[model samples]
Target: MNTMFDSSNPASAPRVWEVGALCHAIGDALQARFNPVAVRGEISGFSRAASGHCYFNLKDAGGQIRCAMFRRNAEQMGFYPRDGELVEVRGRLGVYEQRGDLQLVVEQLQRAGQGAWFEQFLRLKAKLEAEGLFDTARKRPLSTMPRGIGVVTSLGAAALHDVVTALRRRVPHIPVVIVPALVQGAQAPQSLVDALQKMYLLAQSGQGQEADLAQKSPLIDCILLVRGGGSMEDLWAFNDEQLARTVVQSPVPLISGVGHETDFTIADFCADLRAPTPTAAAELVAQPRELWLGALDLLQDRLESAVQRVLDRSAQRLDLAAQRLGRPSEQLSRNHLQLARQAQRLRHAMLFKLQRMTQNQQALQAQLPQSLQRRLEQQKQGLERMDLRLQLLDPRLVLQRGYALLTDTKGKPVTQIKQAPPGAALKAQLADGAVDVVVTQPRLL
Candidate 1:
C-alpha cells in the first residue's frame, strides 16, 4: 500500500509453505460448509470404480452431495443402491485438492422411505405372481388329519413354542418336527428358502431311506413357515419375492403365518394356506381330538349294534332247533299199538342183521381149520417132491453115484481143460471124498 510499508519484508510477503497452507485451509473451510451433514435424497450417478470404490450422488429437492463408498463398507450393506432409489447418507465433506471437486466419504447409506423399496417389492411381486406363484389353483389343500407336522422358525423365537403348544393341544399324538432357521434380517430370506425347499423335497420323495433335493439329514412331511408379529421392516424377509415363490412352488402344502393377525406378507399370498398367527397355523395342520373322540364313540356304537344283531340271530336259531326237538312223534306212535308193532319190527330187523353176521362168521371159522390142514398136507408133499429133485441135482449125490467133479486149488470148476493150468494145484471130488492132486499137463479133450 505504501511501497510494501516503505520496506519490503520477505517474512511479511508470505513464505511458500505458509501460502500453500493458507490455500489448503481455505479449501477445507469450503468443504466444512457441508461436512457432517445428513443428506436425505434418492441415489443417482452411481458408479463403482476399478479401485473397488463406489461413486454416487445424494440429491433431494434442495441440493445434492457426491458420495464415495469404499469397497469394504459397500460390501457390508445388505442391498446395493441403484439410481433414483431413495437413500439416506452420512459422510464427511471434503475437497479433492487436485481436482478441486467437493466430495463426501460415505459412512452410511439406507432406504429413505418405503417409496423405492415398496416399488421394487411390487414389481417383483407382480412378476412372480403373474407366473402363477400366487394362483389358488396351484395351492395344495391341508390334510384333515396330518400324520406329522413340520415347522420352520427361528429356534429361539417365541413363535416356535407357540406353534408347538397349539399343535399339541389340538392333536397330541401328531409329531411336530422343528427345522430351525433365521426369520429376520439379511439371512432370513435365504434361510427360509432353504427350509421350504427341504420340506417340499421330503414330501415329494415319500417315506424312504433316501435323500431329497435339499440333501437335509432329516426329513419331514408338511411345512409350516411361521414367525411372530413384527413391523413391516422386521417382516421384510418373508416379503422377499424369491421366498414367496419358493413357498408357492413347494410340493408340500405350506402354511404361512409370518406375523400377527394384522400382519401379512407376499408369502401369505403365495402360500397354500395363510393363518393369522403361528398358533393358528399349527391348529390348522393338526386334527381336533374332540372330533376323533366322537368318531370313536360312533364306531363303538356300531360295533355294539352289530354284536347284538349277531346274538339275536343265534338265539332265534336255538329256539327253532328246540321246537323241532320237542316234536319227536312217529305218526302218533302208529296209532299207539301200530307204533309198538313198528318198533318191534325195527328191533327184529336189526337182530336178523346180527344173526346173518354170526352165520357168516361160523362158516368162516369151519373153513379155516380144513383149509389149514389141506394146505399143510400139500406143503408136506411139495417138500417131498423138492427133496427128490434136490437129491437128483445135488453134487454130493452125483459124487455118491460115482460121478467126480474136478476143481482148481482156488475152487474154480475145471469145466474147460485149458482152465487147469499146468503145475497148478487141483482137487477131485471122488465118490468117498475129495482127492487133492497136482495139475501136471492139461489133456485137451
Candidate 2:
C-alpha cells in the first residue's frame, strides 16, 4: 500500500496550488455551498462612491463580512443605507483573487425589520402627520427680512459657526442671538425645548423685560434649530415627540436645520421651514444686504425720474401759460383795443337800429289814417245793417202784424194744448200788455 504523504512515494505527493488558483478553488467551494447567500447585520462605514457603487461592512457581535453593491444593485435600494443601520443583504459570496479575501457581491439590500429606532421614528411621524402637524398649510413662511435671528444648537457644534458665518456674511446689520443647548443624547430634546422657550421670551419681551423695553435687544423674528450631520442614533434627539410639539409652538417661525440634506426628523416636519443645513437656514431668514440695497437704489432712481417728469410737465405748462399771457402791460393794451373795437361796433349798430325804427314809425304813421278811415266806414255800414236785422227780428213788429203770444200761468209760452190744460190758468201776452185768463177747455189749432 502507498501512503499519500509518504516522502519517498512521488505518485502519492499532495498537490500544491498557486495563490490565485487557491483563491479560485475556495470561491468555487463557497459558490457551491451558498451562491445566493442572505445576511442580516448592522451596517458599518457605509459609503457610496461617485461611480454609484456602494461599499460597506455588515457586522454582528460574533462576526462581520465585507460587502460591495455595484451601481445597478445600489440603484434598486429603496432607502439610502447609513452607518449603524441594520440591514439584510442577498448576494453571491466569493473570495477576491486580488487580496485573497472573502467578499460579498450584493445583488439586493433592504432594511432589517425597519430597525427599532427607525420603526419608532415612522410611528411618530405617522401620528404627527395624522394630527396635521406636518401639513404644508401649517408651515409658516420665513420672514424675508427678520429683525433678528435666534439659533438653538450645541455651544461646540460646527453648525453654530457655519450659521453665524453665513448670517454675518449676508446681512451683517441683522442681529443674531445664540441660545446654546444640548444637541445630542437623551437630554438634548428637553434642552432644545428650554432654549426655544427662552428665545420666545426674549423675542416677546427682551430678556424678560417689559414690552416697551424689548427694543434693548432686537426682536427675534425667526428661530433656527440646527445641528451638524450625524448617524440616526446620534441625531435621535430631533425625533423626540416633545421636541416636535415644541417646534410647532415657537412664537416666531421656526427653521429646522438638522443633520445633512438627506436626513429627516420629526422636528423637521413640524418646523415652519426646513433647511438642508444651518448655513442654509441663515440664508433663508436673511436676504443679502446687497440685494435690498440694489432694490432701494432702483426705487430711488424711479422716484427721481417721476419727480423729473412732474417738473418737466410743470415747466411746459408754465411755458405755455407764459406764451398765452405775453407781458402784463401788452396783454392789458390788447384787451383795451378789443374793448374799443366792440364799443365802436355797438355805437354803429345802435345808430342803424334807431334809423330803421324811425323809418318804420314814419311808414306806420302814414298808413294809420287810411286804415282808421276804412275801419270807421266799415263799422258804420255794419251798424246800419245790424239796425235793419233788429227791425226784422222784433216781436213788436210781429204784434203790429196782428199776432198775440200765449203763456201759461208759470209764464212759459204755451206752444201746445197739453201745456194749457182745461184747469190751467194762462196769460195772453200782447206787444204792450199781458192779460191773465183761465182755460175751460183747450183746443188744438
Candidate 3:
C-alpha cells in the first residue's frame, strides 16, 4: 500500500484543512436545520452596518449571544433596542458561512419583563382615557354629609381599623359598614371587586344581609378601598387592570386609599379621589366636630351682628321721626292762618272781577233800545224817499195826473208821432183805464 493512498485508488485521505472545511459545512447545515426562535436578553454591543443590518449581542448576566437584525426586521419592530436595553428577539439560529461563526437572524423585537408590564399599563391607560373613563365629567362628586359609608378591606388589616377609628373621631353619628375582603394575593382583586358590587347592590335594594346574621342598612353613599403599604408584587392585586376598569365603571364615587403616602397603584388613577392613607380617606369623607362647631359659631356671630345693625337702623329712623313730631303746633297753626288770608284775598279779587262784568252788561243793555230807534228812523226816511222815486218812474202815475199816454203797435209809447205806421192800432191810457184806437193815417206833427 502507498503511504499517501491505498493502491486500490489514486485518491488519498482528506487533509486536516479539508476535514476542517467539511466540519464547517456540517455546522452550517445544522444551523440551517433549526427554525426561527425568540430569545429575551439585554443588548450588550450594538452596531449598525453600512448595509442597514444591525449587529448586536443579546446578553444576560451569565452569558451572551450574537444577533443580526436586517433592515426589514428592524422596520417591523416598533422600537429598536439600545445598549443595555432588555428585549426579546425572535429569529433563527444559523452559522455565518463567511466567518464560520454561529449567530441569530432577528425577525422581530419587543420589550421584555418590567418593560412589558409598563407598556401594557400605558396601553390600558390610553384605552380607558379614550373611552372617557378618566374624564372629569364621569367622576361623581362626593356628598357633603352622607348617611352611610362603606369600606372594603381585609378583616384583620390595620388599615381597616385606622379608617374606622378616624371616621368615628370625625363624625361619630355617621354609620360605617365594612365589607371584609382580601386586599392582596391572587384572589384579592376579584374579592375586592365582588365586595364592592355587593355593597352597591345592597344599597340599591335596601337590604344588607350579613354572613352570620341578617340586618338591613341605610343606603351606602361612598366606598373606600383601603390597604396597607407593600411592594409592587405584594400590592399587585390593587394594581390589577381589571380592578382599575371595575372602579371606573362603578356608578358611585370611589375613594382609593391603597398602600402608604408614597405608594400608588392603578386603582388610584381610576378612583374619583386618592387618599394618602386609610385614615386620610376617612377624614376627607367626614366633617370634624370642632370644625362644625367653629362654623356654627361664625354663623351665630353673623346673625347677631345683622340683627343689631337692623335694630340700630330702625331706632335711628324712629328717633328722626320723633324729632320731627316733637315740634310745636303753633307754627302749623300760623301757616294755616297765612294760607286762609291768601285764600280770602283771592276771593276778593274774584268778586271785583264779577262786579266789573255786571257793569259792562248794564251798559250794553242801556245802548240796545237807542240803537234800535235810530235804525227804525233811518228806515222810515229811506222808505219815504223810495216812494217819491217810485211815483216819478210810474207811467200810471203820469196818467193819474191827468195827462194821457198813448202807445202804438208793438207797445211803444207815442211820445213822438214818427213811431206810428199807417193804419196801426193805438192804445190811450186814462187815470183808471186804457182805450184802443186805430190810426188811419199818420200825423208827423
Leading candidate by lDDT: 2
Which regions of candidate 1 are displaced past 4 Å?
1-112, 205-221, 321-445
Candidate scoring better on TM-score of 2 and 3: 2
What TM-score does candidate 3 get on C-alpha atoms? 0.44
- TM-scores vs. true structure, each candidate: 0.45, 0.54, 0.44
Number of the top-ranking candidate, with TM-score as the measure? 2
Q: Which residue pairs come into collision in candidate 1?
A: none
lDDT of 1 by residue, 1-445 (tens): 4555323566556445654566577668866676787677888898888887899888888888777898888764545577997877777777655665667788766677654665666677778778878888887888877766778899899999998888878888776666678999999999988977766655676442332243333344568999998756888998887787677677678899888876657888888899999988888888788887676556545534543454344345434433333211222223434433543454455346535644655523333345444553554454345334423433445567777778776766677877777887788878677888888877865
* Candidate 2 lDDT by residue in tens digits, 203-249: 78754543344546668889999999987777889999988988888
Write down the lDDT of every candidate, Cα atoms only.
0.69, 0.77, 0.71
Instruction: List model 3 lDDT by residue over 50-93, tens digit each.
Output: 88789999989888877988987776443445689778877888
State model 3's lDDT.
0.71
Candidate 3 at 90: error in angstroms? 18
Can you give the lDDT of residue 316 in candidate 2? 51
